[model samples]
Target: MTLGNRKKNAVKAATAAKVDALLVTHLPDVRYVSGFTGSNAALVLTGNRAVLFTDGRYTAQAKAEAAGTRVVIEKKPAVTAACEWIERAGIQRCGFDAAHTTVAALEAMRKAVTSKVRRSLFHPVGALVAALREVKDADEISRMRVAAALGCSLFDQMLSIIEPGMTEIAVAAELEHQARLAGAEGMSFDTIVASGERSALPHGHATTAKLPRQGFVTLDFGVILDGYCSDMTRTVHMGNALPGEHEAYDAVLEAQEAAVAVVAPGVTAGDVDEAARSVLRRAKLDRFFTHSTGHGVGLEIHEGPRLAAKQTQPLAEGMVITIEPGIYIPGRFGLRIEDMVLVTATGGEVLTPSPKAWIQL
Candidate 1:
């Protein structure tokens, strides 16, 4: 692939692994490693050269779409093309992505290549690619910031328009419509519009249930931009605020803020989760605040370095994660506040700058 620096990065990683070349077969890794978004393609990544092999179904489109990787149109099975390429290139000790290939495929590769050359399987070539993607450059971070801001604007757009008569599905649809109009490619996941008793469900998706005028209505949504992603959540009252709802909402906001405040390079993900959970425990609401504080997000909404009590990974500079805290009182109501954040040199930078105070919709 002739990508700006990705080809070079993949080549460098191959060299570091002491392999003559890397054969990428995973679809996502194929896209990430060589910018080949096609359904069928194998990327052969060498130090100074690369090749993209695909079936005849996409001969012309592969050539046009995958300009980064040199296209090789093959009418039959793809493994044959890979072996033939390896033999012609006189490559020795080539590496394949073990994560993507099956045992049968590995055997076929072994049988195809000459015994004089060695064949090895690497658990993940995508790992190297993912590690590279973890660091959000200024350009990437700015896109994410825009995504979050657009998501907030969409919330604003949908707020006044929504009334107690609408179903949760109706509210979610309008939120998505507003987000798309505000320049988001689409939501990273299904829009969550849980209200009243339904709010007790942690991942409660929008059902046909109509919203109640007083308890909690949790709105969780995210936007995508240029292959990057942003996530955010805000819970509000349907009409007038309830007495205890404000307290729970404030506690969730405080817990989320506490988690976000302590995020920095060298901090453990589990510690960040505890920072939020501790606040809920002090309020005797720890049992209600379930799920991880957050998770690393980028090309994929949920990536590595999970921010949960069960994880031990440390936060690193350039890593972007979310800080979300919630309290769910079963069959009653629930509230949550979430934001995307970047781990920086000093501490954390909250990319989603929207106000977290409970909205009276």
Candidate 2:
């Protein structure tokens, strides 16, 4: 969709919510609507007009990038200027994202307007623009595909160089360096290189700990390309795996694949989670499978339509999400197998189709 269409859709949503205008201060939402990518920005949307507010630092950049909106460069803060503009435009009720707005921020926003309308001007709209962003357009899906492919290539390269004696941080550094060389804008998040017992930590960041000779090394990472993010996790063994180690890896793989199989249009996110959890439950490892099954991924690493127990959000076509299932046995070992799966009309398509089989480095 073009930037103008996106703004039009947002305005339609604001109208449905009984608001005259929407004050979008979230950076990603701002980018999605107006194509403005600067650090400071605020987009005000009405039925007939769209205006982007920013400081002088982004005067030229905002004007150039924000294609469908009128650019207003002001010396004051962007949000304050946007609120003031809304009042001047005679907007009675302006919607703002309650999820992203803070108490202090709301107070400041109200202070920007006159006392008569300050108390009731800004209405609390819950994730108005974020809901629109959950489903990927063709352009967004194309960019995400490239990002996922880069992550898969990086994983393939890491298999050749990872050894038992290498430090976890060193492995992360090499992976990041290669990503930069491969034209990645940055990493989606801090690279995770959890080894040995540290694998039990779901979000174990790269540390100085050395890789173990006979334990699992979990590499969970993502990359950003063309303003999109890709996330996948692969756990490999250093030397020989113990008797139960191989079995655990197999169980996690089965669970991850099972979840990926159920991803399709009209499927509930909870059903997908249950599909993975049922596999681990059959293996008697469900207790160790901490965290949700997965989450939606796109402009942000984590988005809406969470795949977890009791989540009722239905999967829609064009939504990209992750299917990651793991078992963390504290002090003993842990393993995770993840893939970026795109929801399609028929079923899920694995974006990161690198080797998920047992890899003993």
Backbone clash count, each prediction separately: 0, 0
Off by over 4 Å in 1: 1-4, 26-28, 55-68, 77-126
Who wins the TM-score comparison? 2
Top lDDT hit: 2
- Residue runs of model 2 more than 4 Å from their true location after superposition: none
Residue lDDT tens for model 2, 1-361: 9998999899999999999999999999999999999999999999999999999998889989998689999999999999999999999999999999999999999999999999889999789899999999999999999999999999999999899889999999999999999999999999999999999999999999999998999999999998899999999998898879999999999999999988899999999999999999999999999999999898899998799999999999999999899999998998899999999999999999999999997
What TM-score would each prediction reach against the true structure? 0.86, 0.99
Worst 10 residues of 1 by lDDT: 117-126
Please give the CA lDDT of all the candidate structures: 0.80, 0.94
Q: Give per-residue CA lDDT, model 1, range 110-204, as digits (tens).
A: 77766665344322344556556676667767778888778878777777777787899999998888777777877899999999989988899
